[model samples]
Target chain A: MNKQKPSQILKTTFFSFLLIALTSCTKKSDKEVSLGALIAMTGPIESMAPPILDSVRLAEKEVNDNGGILGGRKLKVTVGDSKCSAEGGADAAKKLVNINKVSGIVGALCSGASTAASSGVAIPAGVTMISPASTAPTFTTLKDNDLFYRVIPSDAYQGVYLGKLVIKQGITKVALTYVNNDYGVGLANSFKASFEKEGGKVVTESKHEDKKASYRSELATLAQGGAEALVVIAYSDSSGQTIVRQALETKRFERFIGTDGMASEKLIKRIGIQGLKKSFFSRPVATKTSFSDAFDKNYGAFSKHKRKSIFIKEAYDAAMILALAIQKGGSDDRASVKANIRKVANAPGVEVGPGDWAKAVKLIAEGKEINYQGAAGANEFDKNGDVAGVFGHFVVQMGDSFKQIK
Target chain B: MDTLYGWMMYILSLLTVGGIYAIMGLGLNLQWGITGLFNIGVAGFFAVGGYASAIVTTKFSPNHLGGFDLPFIVGILFSMIFSGLMAAIIGKICLRLRGDYLAIATIGLAEILRLILKNEVWLTNGPRGIPGIPRPFEDLAQPWSEICYLLIILLILAIIFYGFEKAINSPWGRIMKAIRENEEAAASTGKNVENLRLETFVIGSIFMGLGGALLTHSMKYIGPTASDPLVTTFLLWVMLIVGGSGNNKGAIIGAFIIWTVWSASELLSGILSYEWINRLSYLRVFIIGFILQVILQNRPQGIIPEKN
Candidate 1:
């Protein structure tokens, strides 16, 4: 019995050591240049993520097709759904950085999700992040900073532009109705500040919680307030659509203005042509642009319907910029790649896009200067890592079409 | 100095969380410890309180509900009352079941409540949630006064604790204990066990509701995601168990200790640079589990075992 016990103990010890060695070996061999993409694939903000993910995939396919980055090392983009919540985003970020050992991350479509993931997982892991859509100003001023970058300008810039647009529309008194979220509040406050500064009067400012049915009374109140224009700042979800529909039904205001969150093809689809007409929304214009044609062609091939929203173009540009930066760095080293992102994205000279990246990459490799003007516009990352893009006011015309007011 | 201040702030934050959890734990203790009624749906009641108070206070428009912007005290009071009322209704239906069946029913109800919050965009703002809720002391001359906020919450907790203590000491508490020890024996002694259990369940739910309201105000943001089962439900259970189940002081102490550990672990993880430690985020959960196991082994009754 004693001899049998000794033999069993020895066998157990051998297996334990063998298991540890196997695990270590697996860890060492698993460096396939993993890059994490955290997007809201579910939850309230989920509608915004699918297009972003598609854009990331398109970029990945293009990179891999052209012999990949870092001396033929194929780039793998692992997408994680943040669910647009703090805890969920943090969990997704952790899994991406820890389990996948991803050197770089792109995503967190929602602002709150970005904040949660950035603070908890990405920054701590020293993984560089470039969000395509998150526009909260607070992210640029994080206390425990990391190599954070974004292709979209802050709501600060958008708010000013929106305010200017409102003033230019010859509307003096405006009624502001916003969803009670950070995204809405921040943009609304900024617009209010700049609008008031620009000599525009906001008659009645009210906040509505998102996703409630029947906004007829609120719309009526805004109408009753005798405001010429109503500014709706909210997500491009059902709630925002409901608000717009209710406003249209009431026929209260002369004009309706919406922010970027309301600048979506889904919004048009939800509200139909009749609801969308006479409504002017501020969005990053994609027409008469270099990459717009290419995006239209590529997205036309990929999607049954031609992609015509500003978000799709911005998301595509964000992915393209990240890929270009990786190509410029000549290595998958996260820190160096992160540092070089701003350089490649906001490079000097002619603007570039996914189609132009090959030539740009070759020139960059040969120590020549290049500028990447994306489909959305110039990918210029400002001092705070925000892009400076033109925010144009577009009036929805006939079915699925909008005319930008120059 | 900054580090110390941060730690102080963390402790203060934990105290606030602990106070809320303690109140929640007391409710559980009243049900499980006193009346032998098991309710795993504390989160549901808590969420109801938050949503109810939020909708009531905020104004309602044709498109969305607006907050009434009432005083925080009024909101808190309304939350408690509504939660208690909800508990009475739920208890009337499910409290008749004993043991695991009752637990399952409550848990299912909690899940249903969460789904309602998530899907009913018209009511709870769906998944996007409500933000920019008015802070209690925003109108104060010095607004960012954590001390004032802490003291106010602490005072509220004290009153609740005192009230609970007084109630538990009275004849009502004895009957509750009697029901807990042996329902049949209590019935034989001419006690209405069902009514006592229902009352205990309702009262406990009220505390949970109030705690939820207080918590929402502290964050100044309320979302369906925040009141999730994993975040609110699991944590409450951890707090109650770590504290002695039947003891209010133990509940408070457990909440404080566990929250401190959780916060400290997070801070440690944040500051550490090692790849292994940085990567091993789940290590914290494992450590918590291990510590809990050790505690259970060494002191099965908990940090402060309830005294009969």
Candidate 2:
């Protein structure tokens, strides 16, 4: 038995290596112009995926219908679930960039997932990945080699907006507890920095991990310093619901503030609307333009009765922008498409929106550049591929729905 | 030809990931298969190893300790030591308990460590984990850098695997098996079962730590999510059980099989019809569970059984 061990191991390794050698001979055709969407199809952020995915699908369908990019080559989206985690995001990105051979990727909804996907696979593979919902401030300064971009503004902007909103509401002293992760910490730190700069006292600050059974102790720690409100930065389905429920159960803090992650009716249902009495949250709002209207018209039926998440419009815009860039770039090459992203999305061009796909393609073909004012807003991507977005301040109403507050 | 090479590179990457998981599974196999020690907090030790190495090796991260900027080799060593030390502490307390108690303790241990990694921002930098970790031979160009890293990891895995095989077949391994089979009997024979169990746990954890460090270095990023207990611990357990808990080769084989299936299903879901994509995502989980069920029902000793 002992003598056979080495040979058995050698045989197994050899066999597995042979399998790899055989599989490597198989080919992936790059005939179709495929755009990959990396989203949280499963895991903690599953609730937010459907609308984003639907929006991407809607864009792909619309593009394919409208004579597709680069002389009638149909546009397709290969959807890979980021699983809203680092390792999962890396794996998803690997499949998209390597196996599927997508020209461009729109996705990796969470900040950590985005970071993981970009750094681990996307950037290394030289595949362009534009995130729709990743808002960690760290993303603003990532060493992406110009391969990464985001339609949504970083959390720094949101943090400043949240701080100003809090100050406007006369909330000087607030306890802050954010989910412990890239999104949570980035938002929390930025909010704290901005709020302190605005002369608002952060009475206490704490952080909590996701999927914990109870956070009464964390709440107690935050409440110890005696704050008027709690600013919670976390996803609604993950730590946000638990924190809100625990706070209400303990009756530690009545008034709560949340970021985009907590801006959902799902949160209201998790911790009853009655439980979220004086709570309000901030999220990026879709511009009520023709583009937004077009999105609602296209995806509204598919996403019937589901509460709209913050990044659905942004997701639509991300897909549309990538497709438009591909059209404008007039090439199937990844690098050329990446180069045209800023040119087509930014300023000094004819204005275009969601309904102008064919027109936009026509204009680009005629050598006249067109700026894509997407559903999110005038998506004039900065050098970093980030666009400034409008923020909505919403308060929970009597019927478990959020009514946007002035 | 480019497409074929792309597929080859993709497989190479997948194998790299599998290699790391196999190392982790091997660590778990040593504990559960050979010593009858159930350690579910594999992620905790992994996190400790990863974070320790990340902190020590990288230039100081703002809001967290850094600036040590040790070499990659030093980072690997630091990770192993840190993880082994953590296992020693955890083992001292939890090893007294048996079976389910140990499982619960380990689960809680991993959860607590995850919480610590999250909330202790000044230490672990909260959720904005340490990124931009330097891979070995990173200065090398494109495919070469990756290929070099893969070769290095393969060499490391080979060493660990060979050493493990040697250790398991030795008198120490027999004693471990004895303690695993009948702890009281081994104790009556003056084998010092508790001490032996502690040693086995620590040694196994050292490999796990090295695996974690390799993962962090390879990805060149580490976050709380990277060490997620469900992804790391549970998945590794499944690999061990599926591969054959008592068989070292089985552990490595199980890792490759399960990880390949896990990733390949995601690719399949992407290719499927739009209407079925969402359902297929859930079905992927079902497939994994179903595979486990089938494996358990048919080959309960796993595809490769213990060579007793």
Candidate 3:
């Protein structure tokens, strides 16, 4: 036994120590309330992540500036990348809940990430997660035990609204192409059900996986359905640009409708302003309130990345709600934060809008209830932690800008 | 105290996932390393195994079919059988192709399988995927359940490693290697190269299936994303190649090292500030590729060279 090489033993020991050092680095500050921001910092929806993450940091700074939560215990945010997939979401949630010891998580922008993280890690670990952008109705069925919440309305609402709007705009026939994931399938099914119910015919619906070299064949198949318009539900950074560009080049279907995922200036830049002139899309409205204004002003300071402002409002709102809940819950305990999240966001209290956290903290100290009306919309969560918000109708005008259409 | 536990649990999850991939790496080693068959559709057989188990075990739902509510062991057994059957079918036609052509065909098969999983809404439930998969011993409290599952993975990996080591050292394995070196020479020497290749392919795919089945159970979900060619197929190749092509122990070590690098990079991204993560969002990917390049350059025969 003693004949074994000492160098091999030394090498093995060194590697073991290195592994331990690499894995054991979580240290929670006693004077801080840590919140996790699990977002799509990479993967297919990478383009949309920066502004939303920036908004979260802005809200974090605002919370700390306003005397922090629970009498100067500063609110610190730890960001985790969801990568917009179930596995990515679950891994991120595990790190956030277990390693970071965050009282609450403020994202998971994609639906697949939201539900997966909840079932896989967050709910089991008793960590509260408030999604700012995940809108799939599938989340409504999660046996989350009251640990899951979201700032956006479900796709059910958006589908119904858009379906009605498509018909009202005199589009009688439409073909649909959606990304073949939870987000796409859920929204597509909802829209199909609503569109058919509204006496409109969906000529054909196709699902596309992301990162395909060309969607020309899918576009051709969609065009063959003799539809007057196409409804594309996909992220701008993925197959959305290619689908739009190919559809335009082939003159397959000039008239198009899109959802929030495609509501971006990048879409216009890719397809050109003239290419998308006949296109209209629906997305959650960014309210012109004090909260949004403050967010727009402060976002640049935190991040130099160009702001798309798509889900930035919701991100800010989610961060604010988590922080306020931490303050009202009176401790950094996750259970306490989860229990009191609704207390700070519902009605029958003094109204607190964006930038009013200092006042809201004062009101909470004075034994007064407060309702936080977020920059995105009314901050109310139903039994399922779902919100109801208005979807804005917009058209791409000249100069690659979105013009709100009444 | 909880932080320490959290870190431990996080490491356990990484090891568990790494263990599953180790099984896959072993299977690929049997095909590409031992038998000289480039079965690049590692994820295809994996998905087949995952769906086979998921269909039988999951409860009856309107979304998909065959919710037989079978026991967990039945699911695992069926997953292996199903994947083996698929490998047999694919190998029957594709084993005729050699080298690069086999690689191309297997990669295409993987894409075709992913498409089928996506479009066959009635069968695989399409992109929404099969969630709510019941993990064995899920009734146990969390971190404990997770730890138990990790043990299960480790047990499976150890069994596979032992079995694979024995198989590759057997007379049958020597014939496969002879065929891999020179098929014409092996055929002339009275070995049925075609049949041996097919048998090896099927056997290798069965191991991949078991790995996939275990992963699906642990994750409690299976989707198209889970079977991404880049993650499952390419990464397994990197694992086997980087660890050592023909050595079973090397394959396991490779899986652990590569998966640790993959996950650890993501963890680093999380630790870095948003400005750094945003400006260099692909830094994780860059680091992985750079490490692989360095390994490939420094050890062309792999960290553990294939034993003669």
Candidate 4:
């Protein structure tokens, strides 16, 4: 090997990498206050990222158009793909916190990603992170040191709610199956505990892997349990779809119960209304608020898929609340944003909603308080930064829709 | 902090994670490069290490098994021990199968490990995972805490690197190299080839476990998805192969360089248009593959080829 060749190659590669690093270190304009969005752009939730990003962009646009943030400085959002895993989340969040120096973060959507980012990066780095889609029960008890918050409720609460709903419907014995993941496990375990406590019986339980060719053997065992219905705690596009179709064809359990993941139009299209006539699904209901009219009227202009996805409203709420917190705190400091999140989200303030950022800013300037009522609901965050969820019970209608029964 | 300091902090993260991967690269180098043991089941040992470390060190929680709340060194040892035990069992059964067949068995081991971690709710907390694994020096201030953690990782890497170097130069190293080149001839010389192969397998796996434990502590959380084969298994192979597998320094250098590329490519969006930032961000994975292909074409034996 030539002596100069190795050094030449090394120098060339080293300078190029230095160039990339230097380019990324370009400073943010002082006129802008930046935030980070940790969406799952490449992992399991890739399908859900587009609209969620749109919602975040909507919040940014709405805030800028109204009054901007902090006496008319632009509110900029930097995007980081969490990739729906711990490593991805930690890496993205580290870049956001250290390199971009974002005052607050609004994502890392998957629960596992969120947990790692919050505990490992954001909390330690003193940057506040708010997740709109992560619903693992772990965050409720995680020692986040007051730096982590989520607009959505944990799956543990929803599981208990489903448990009570099932008993109220007079269904005693049911065979349960959940796709094995954080969401499925959290919801299923909590539901089982609550159901058993409320004098109901889960005759058999099975946890199956998602995206499988068939769950025939698992279904065979579940079918033998002699149950009133089959509770499928999985997404409609994955294992839930297969289980439902197989159960229908085999004449297993006639009645069925599903969670928000199963409450979709695609289910009716494939299974038809007849097969799902005895089936009902549960989903978190968007509350009727004064802001609802504004969101319904204007959100269509901003987003193509207005109601096509879950957590769009919550996503909007998370970003908007961050902006409001920045305005209320009147500083670009990380600690300021963390201290102000609950102040702007909680009660006893002049109510503000989406597209009303100007009024909210004016209120903050006046040394008055304002509570942000967002597109989703009045997200009153508890001590753990979790909101109490309100779920709706729905049954399949004759056409391609679901009717809220209660 | 200022932008330059921010950049430095990000570099520390790069090295922290990079050092961990270097540990894994060393293990892969020992097994495949030194002993020619085709053990592709690094992900299984990795998960075992992560879960064991997490279970051993975490505070009392109803989730998963352990509430012992042991210290950091204990967590690391447990992770290595558990992974070593798994390697011993699997090596006893499948180490006899050479080359590609061993690859298939290791793949099965990875899948089985992932399934167990996902399904065994009472033990491993199922897929919800055990959160809040302790990080040493986390109680200190920002840059210092991060500095200390990175130092600890580098120190571990140094010890492992030193140990491997000593081992690679010893007479035992010559015998292992002999076995790698001509296994039948080495066995004919009565070097106890099977035991040496098993020893190499178990020792390499012990380092992989250490890598996994370090990752868990740094990330402060672990789940089944975090141990995805794409990152854990395939990436280790690329690192060792690109670094020139025969030498320990190549393994270390390859890990740092590859990880730097893997991580810094995500920041390319800083120069792109706002509309293209999110859309073009995925080109990172493509960029890594492109670089790997370019390097393979230029230098098949890697950047620092084994010096005979």
Candidate 5:
């Protein structure tokens, strides 16, 4: 065994290399139009990736089920794991663009990955990229050459919408806390600007980082200022849950408010509905027809966390919309996909809802316009390729669930 | 033809990232192989370099942020300087200790540095990070800009490798080897062993920072995730050891080999559909660990041993 050590190691290396070579020889056929999905398969928010990819695949299945895309060509989706970082994004985008040679991409959920992949790889390669959940306002001004777009509303839009809803509830004074990152800061800044303009008082504000053992110090600051309620703009599963539990235990404030980040059933289950009876949350309003019956049924065959999985709706929409663009443009060309994203997702067109692929394709075939009011909502692309979204008010119901107010 | 162009760009990127890792591997080789210092804070120095360059490229004050159009070299120089300064401080405190104690001290300190980079949003932009860093020759047309960037990286790597080789043959290089072999014996000869060790460590750390800055420039973005210890610090150590400690060429070869496998294994695994989703992504990490184990088991002295 000792004498054979070096050769054995070499053999192992050779074997693995051979495996890689054999696995990588998958050839794309001419009858298929490939789109890439750049999701974080490994990293901090890794648990969410597999499910979200399934939702995007669900869109692919939806397209292929109803005849196909681009004059009977099958829609093929190649997956690239962005790993939730800039380097990961650039690396994955390079492979997806070069090796896979996809015309479009969808669902790089992390903002950092989306920006880097867009600017570094996708934009330079002239590939159209649609992020399912990147909400940075910076993208609005990115020199993307109109090749980048997102299904999610900009943080700027959701925050401003939430501010109007807060004032409608007649809460004039409140304490505010948010996780100090791009998502939190963007939403908080927009919310503050809109709330202050609507004649409300943000008596105190504190920004805290995520995954801390305790947020008592920040909570203490928020507890002061004699505010009527405390606002939390953070993910419910982590820091948001900790802050809410600590706040109630300390009896600092009776009323609580949360933004899109806090709109989760986990909070209601973890903290109990009794303690959060007066608490309210805001999320980007999904239309009733959004996540339609067919979508729910199709997605049910995969993960049970349909409502709980973050960005599943947006991921589905992003894939479907990109498919629609390819179909409407009548080609698998990257430039045409970019050129027709707006044409397929905006008003003054034949209305298409989720799972209405057949209807949309028929309209496209007839040389009529098509509009994809998707699983998220009506995705009307603006000059900067951003879609405006409305915020929905939600409250904890008796069954440990969130009931959205229309 | 477009597909062909895309494949070419992909290969260029693999080389680009591999070159960046080779630079960092050289840094680690100097620290561990030349001077016998267990510097475990590679990621800390990396973050310092990346954030330093990012801040230099643009104004990110609380009041206003501006367009980033500064000379890329200025940011790179700043990264190396800041990293060197940080290394100087860390070396002063930890070099007094020996072996594993020094490793523990450096690791703890680096964690503190990581937290500072993460929490201090004004400088590093926290987790959201800074993007749109203009790279040298990025404005040039496709493939050429990429080609130019890769050339600069390889050119830098060659210069550093040549410098290291010359240093190894010089009196300083011989002294470093002496200190590594028998520290007490070298000190008895009044060689100022402490100062020499500190210098080796600081120089090695400077290279780590340089590598980080180049990476940020290549990606045109940086975030807290860029400095993740698993990806940066631990990965560099693997490259150094598997390549061959105390061998400059070994380090370069090691970096290219390891990083190519790391990135390309992902590409290879990308062939697998989501039907095997759970196994696909982790397969890259698994392959890397397997390679490291095989290399360490077969050649503990590395692919290129320190030649007498």
Candidate 6:
């Protein structure tokens, strides 16, 4: 009986293993295409991830509902939160690539996280990453690798836009308050250089430590410099909000201009409508594409609110681009999907939105041409896989809404 | 429904993070509350553990510092031992100094360690960090997979906590406390005060290293930024001070509560109107500071003070 028990146990274990493997293989065979998203669902940038994720989901649903990517083969998306930190981003990337075996990924939103994850795991494993919103200029020169791409224009372009905006506003002198991190420092320096080149003067520049309270002294110094306008390049954290509040409370500058990081509704909410009245910031203009409207509708319904974020638009566009690329490549293979990403993203001709993903995919699969004009705007991919878009300056009017001023 | 789920997930994540902090805080509690060793370099030892485990287990290549791809259990064990060795060396050098001088020396050492991590790109990947670490039990099926993994981690943590409680109640623990209270007397009693102090420092650091290793695994990423003195050093001290210095339960509770508050505030700031939540973010830190002040003023012994 004891000898029979050992054989019986071994037989049961083998059968169990076989069943598991067979089930897994069958599940894989049932899916036509698989994609992954690594977003900062928790941590400092967690607030920004929801919009992006919502958009991705919406795009995925549209594609799958329209008879999948490769003719009846459905596309599936697996989401992982990167926590906006380098380590978290890498881990999320690894899970998506190693465990999920996804063909493409959509995020690692923050520059530092994206950089770390791309170098640490994504590039090494040959997984394609296309960041929709990460705008750090250094990404352009990242190890001469082609695996990483961004849909948004680099900070360098944004700096130039801000510089032109400053000139347009006739603000002769500006005071710069930047966070002491790579994102802030890069934007601040670029803005300074562009502004100086455009014959505008930067009165004073200072850096604020992250998560620091009481920037009254720093604002006091900037106010004392007698600059007509103040430009803040920082994230939407407590410290950055405090800096904005203090600048207004101290009555230092006439008007405040900020980068995309400070362009969130959360920033205005933090400072209050009264404080935000005189503030203007540069952000990617939200195009009135059908895809964007659909995303907005879905997200508003999901959040049970009337408002939607800019990141939602970017994320939706990223997912659509990825799906279109897969269809265009004629396969769900990682390398093929990656190679066709730029082709679909920048396909010359008619524009396609989220609702038209089916038609777009069909056309691409049929070997016809297509161009994707996303909810965020014209997604024309350059050599570096970055999209060039128009930057608009908006004035915070009331109730977490902004009035776009050309 | 999604929002509530989001909150629950957030709470779970915070608890996981707090569990790590609790372990590190316990290490601090052992040194300051029991052995009276002022270790301002807590973050340094933690970073050492993370880097050691990462480099040891990662697949090595010619262009990069190759890792052995050893089992994570073995990597963690080695990391703890290495951290203990480093702490012993540092403790021997700095234990002779008393009061603020020792604090300053340890703080300086912590800064030096951070700089080394930042500059040694060839070894530590510089400021960019190491990513794509393998998680234990990742091969399991989904649905209950993550939960099972978390349960395993929690079980390990419980064992460590119970083990620590047992050690603190032992004769060795009593001697360490004796040295803390009256060093000269402990020396006169042939306790070999220096050796005792060094031994305590090493043991405490081993715990810190283990805590760091667990954290890296949970996060699945390790970076120099994670080891920043601001995040590691300040938060660990806050947990230890607010939780009650000498109590294990206090440490765990403090970590959970503080981390919960921190994470909740972040979520709340996202959901609430920007106006209401904006200033609240900055105010959150001050709130913690206020909590610390209140704790010190009202209950100097902490919510769970160490017992004699």
- lDDT of every model, 2 decimals: 0.71, 0.84, 0.84, 0.88, 0.84, 0.74
Quality of candidate 5 docking, DockQ:
0.54
**TM per model?**
0.62, 0.85, 0.83, 0.90, 0.90, 0.62
Where model 5 places Cα greater than 4 Å from the true spot, the runs are A1-29, A209-220, A223-226, A235-252, A263-280, A301-308, A394-406, B1-3, B59-69
For candidate 1, what is the interface RMSD?
A: 11.1
DockQ of 4: 0.57
Please give, for residues A1-406, the per-residue lDDT of candidate 6 as tens digits: 5456888999999999867866665577456477878777656766666556666777777777777778778887777656667655654565566555678888878776786667655765567888877877767756525788777778778888999888888887899998765567667868988999999998888877778878988888888778988899888765677788877777776578888788878887777777777678897676676756765666666553334665667777778888887888888777887788777777575667657877786676666788887777677878777777678988898667777888
DockQ each: 0.07, 0.46, 0.45, 0.57, 0.54, 0.09
- The digit string of per-residue lDDT tens for model 3 on A1-406 reads 6676999999999999866755554333577788999888888888898888878888988888888889988888988888877778877787887777889999898776776777777877888989998877767767778999999888878888889889989998999999977677788888898999999999987888887979999998999879999999999887888898888889898988999899988888778888887889998776677766665666766778655567888889899999988888898898899899999999878989778879999999999998998888887999988898688899998777898896
Expressed as tens digits, the lDDT of each residue in A138-189 for candidate 4 is 8888888888998888898889999999999999999999988778888998
Q: Is candidate 4 or candidate 5 better by DockQ?
A: 4
Q: What is the lDDT of residue B278 in candidate 1?
A: 30
lDDT of 5 by residue, A1-406 (tens): 5576898999999999866654454334467899999988888888888789889878888888889887778898988888888778888898988888788999587888888888888887789998888988878877789998888889998878878888999998999999887788888888999999999989999998889989888888888899888989999989999999999888888788998778778888899999999988888765667445566767887566655577887889889888988888888788899889998999888788877998888988899988888777788888887888877889988899999875
Q: Which has the greatest lDDT?
A: 4
- How does chain B of model 1 score on TM-score? 0.92
Distance from true location, Cα of A337 in model 6, Å = 1.5
- Shares of reference contacts reproduced by the candidates, in order, are 0.02, 0.52, 0.36, 0.65, 0.61, 0.09
- lDDT (0-100) at residue B248 of candidate 1? 76
| Residue-by-residue lDDT tens digits, candidate 5, B1-308 | 45556667878888898899999988888899898999898989999998888778854444123324468888889889999999999999999999999999999998899889877766676766777777889888887999999999999999999999999889999999999999999999899998999999999999999999999888788777778787798788888888898999889888888888887877754567666655666777787788889988999888988788
TM-score (0 to 1) of chain B for each candidate: 0.92, 0.97, 0.96, 0.96, 0.94, 0.92
Error of 3 at A347 (Å): 2.0
Write the residue-wise lDDT of candidate 1 on A1-406 in tens digits: 5456888999999999867866664554243456778776656765555566667667777777776666667777776666676555665675566555567888777776776567544664567787888887665555324467777778778889999988988888899998876577668878998999999999987778788988877787777667887899987785677887777766676467898788778887877877666678897654466567777677766654337553677777767766777677776666777777777776575466656656776777788666777766677777766777677888887768667777
Reference-based lDDT, residue B37, model 1: 82
Residue A143 C-alpha lDDT in model 3: 75
Query: What number of clashing residue pairs does each candidate have, in the order they appear?
Result: 19, 3, 0, 0, 0, 6
**Candidates 1 and 2 compared by lDDT, better number:** 2
lDDT of 2 by residue, A1-406 (tens): 5566888999999999867765553322334688899888878878778777878887888888888778888787898988888888888888888777788999889877888888878887778888988877777778888888888888888898999899988999999998766677777888999999999999999877788988988998999998999999999998888888888888898899999999987998878877787888898775588877776776776565242566887888889888887888777678887788888888889998876788998898899978898877788777777777689899989888998886
